[model samples]
Target: MQRDKLITAEVADLLRPWFSDVTVGAQPVIGDAPAVLEQPDHAVTLTWRVGSDDPHDIVIMGPRTQARYHLERPGRDCLQLRFRPGRAADFLGRPLRDLADRAVDAADLGSKSLTAVVQTIADGGALAASQSHAARLRSLAEAIPVAPPTHTDRAALHRRIVAEATALLSIGDGPTHEPVHRVARRLSVSERHLRTVFADRVGLTPSRFVRIDRVRAVLARIQQKLPEVSSRAGYYDQSHMTAEFRNVMGTTPDAFARRRWPTIEACTAGNG
Candidate 1:
């Protein structure tokens, strides 16, 4: 049952602190879909491929620092749960660094709650086209065990610092060009400590996170000229911007401008 609505508000709110988004879709992929430029993400994602006969395709993707070029083929009906930065460890009971840049079978993580949810969805035949998103989410919400309170006072404070620092470094309301050292200073921590905590909780160094965020900001300037984008994205010059763009996105701005690549949604359909 192709669900025409988003995840249920009740379940969404229940998981809002841990997850940034929950999406359900079944986009079709043609013979040769355009490659997708998946930018570095600070959060982890769990993707489930439903709507198939023995539908149990579940993958848990961790935080990524490098750019990836993915080719999509065939069609898919999938539900993705995107965790908020630095929050997956609380729910998954593991350090984010261990899972960085890797996509593993969800079962391998050994989360009983996760396994139960997957089994329930598969047994119930919750195809994206057939089952309502509300019902599917209800199943998930019911199956997910409450996260254990394992964090000590100090550990809890460290997580808070990482979350705050992540917000400052990401492409958000504040000035995106803030240097790592400045961010550390503002957060009342040493730059080295900040880097260490970020690598442990966010799976990326502070400088690398800022670099990826800058590229994302530039890409968001879809209506601006190349020079304007370069300047506004805080690059030293157009040449610098081009180099960063190519390094992070694997394409020059000119080529990207000529042929607008599809969004990540299109590439997410295929298992590749």
Candidate 2:
């Protein structure tokens, strides 16, 4: 498969108010994989399954919060627009919470125009065989009506806060855990309000999201053959770590390490 990661330089300043870097990726074919990485919340993915002539081309794969997932490789080539957390709701015109942990066609969500645009990208990824998918995607993002924030819009502010909350919750080798109340106070919202907004816009509640992200961190370490152990990821002990993996990833760490899972990547959650 031909793989390319393109910069969103043209729209970076324009999208900063509401998104992270508008990175674009294009590929000629998707190879089969047995497992998909359990990533932190992903932005909305706009996919164009190449070789498929269906007008409804753009498929939105929502964010996930898990240790791993069984993989299902796509049959065709496509370009993807990974929309950052807290921002997809505006482009989608709906609460992202309702669409969590699933892939829905743009047409199904009343995203007819986007579906059409994705078809264009699919054509771009396939027919524009001459043009790079990244180039095609950059041109495509320019066509969307994602207006930059003009002032301190409350909704815009809310999106920013919720996005930050997701980042803060993606704890690393820090204190293992921080009180949600502290973060809520820092964001100037009540804990309950933060939970509501986070779930509605970011897919998972703060605590659950934190737990899962921490597990992902540990999994990454084990996969890398690093000296780090699960307990270093804030688990109580080796047994606690093993049990967490069995319950969350459905396997033990030793079993998980033998498999291949690319970082910042995805696949179906299959048995390792």
Candidate 3:
């Protein structure tokens, strides 16, 4: 079947220093077949979409693994934003570990500030709920809540560390197996500090995040039919890749390799 692309706008330039991308647009989706909910593999996402029951606004999707779940409503438009790893700290105003694998109702990220706007939509005021989804999100960016510099040296250091760590982990297209010690040494911080910042900021132990990234990376390569997916993508070998893949993805690499993912492919940008 031919692939369909959801419209994606790079609103990253608009929300700097906190959000990496804001994806606003809807795509045509056919009804979906039941499928395993792929583990939490994408970047931290803020999503608003039309649903079977009603509209879902201010849903915060964190990072972690899970079992079966359904996709978003078919034949409906979805709006979403993805935060750069470790960058969600200020906007979310909390540790990410608390929300992993859950799409909990969001209160932060300037959601409270948009209450009047959303309430108006709910009450059939200025805009319908459908129009409100994207507009409210854009309002979120325009709000651009900047905190007064009340943080101590320690807080600023932590942000810098997490930001650098996020960049380090993101290098080379996928996750790295480089020793945490080496990474810490390169970043000029101790391993203990590195792990703490990762947990507090990006919401995973450094090792666990790396493993998830490796598995997700290899799967992306497999999906694209890229060569040497295992080795080139940083797994020690095929066995290593398969074990990690099955652990996070709940399916074997070969199973994913041979299968077509029309539903998964339909809306791509928000996955980060």
User: What TM-scores do the predictions have?
Assistant: 0.80, 0.72, 0.72
Q: Write the per-residue lDDT of candidate 3 for residues 114-195, one digit (tens) a residue.
A: 3433444354432344644444544454555543133578767887787677666642565355667788998898999898
- Per-residue lDDT, model 3, residue 150, is 30
User: Which pairs of residues collide in candidate 3?
Assistant: none
C-alpha RMSD of each candidate structure in angstroms: 4.8, 6.0, 6.5
In candidate 1, what are the lDDT values of residues 136-186, reduced to their tens digit?
666666666555354698678778888788777776643345678888999
Error of 1 at 190 (Å): 1.9
lDDT against true structure, model 3: 0.57
Cα displacement (Å) at residue 33, model 2 = 7.2
The ten-residue window of minimal lDDT in model 1 covers 25-34
Q: Which candidate would rank higher by lDDT, 1 or 3? A: 1
The clash numbers for all candidates, in the given order, read: 4, 9, 0
lDDT of each: 0.68, 0.59, 0.57
What are the runs in model 2 whose C-alpha is more than 4 Å off? 1-5, 8-43, 51-53, 66-75, 112-116, 119-127, 146-152, 172-177, 224-227, 260-272
Q: For model 2, where is the 10-residue window of minimal lDDT?
A: 22-31
lDDT of 1: 0.68
Quick one: RMSD of model 3? 6.5
Per-residue alpha-carbon lDDT of candidate 2 for residues 222-265, written as tens digits (9 for 90 to 100): 75443356556776677777776666666667766755443334
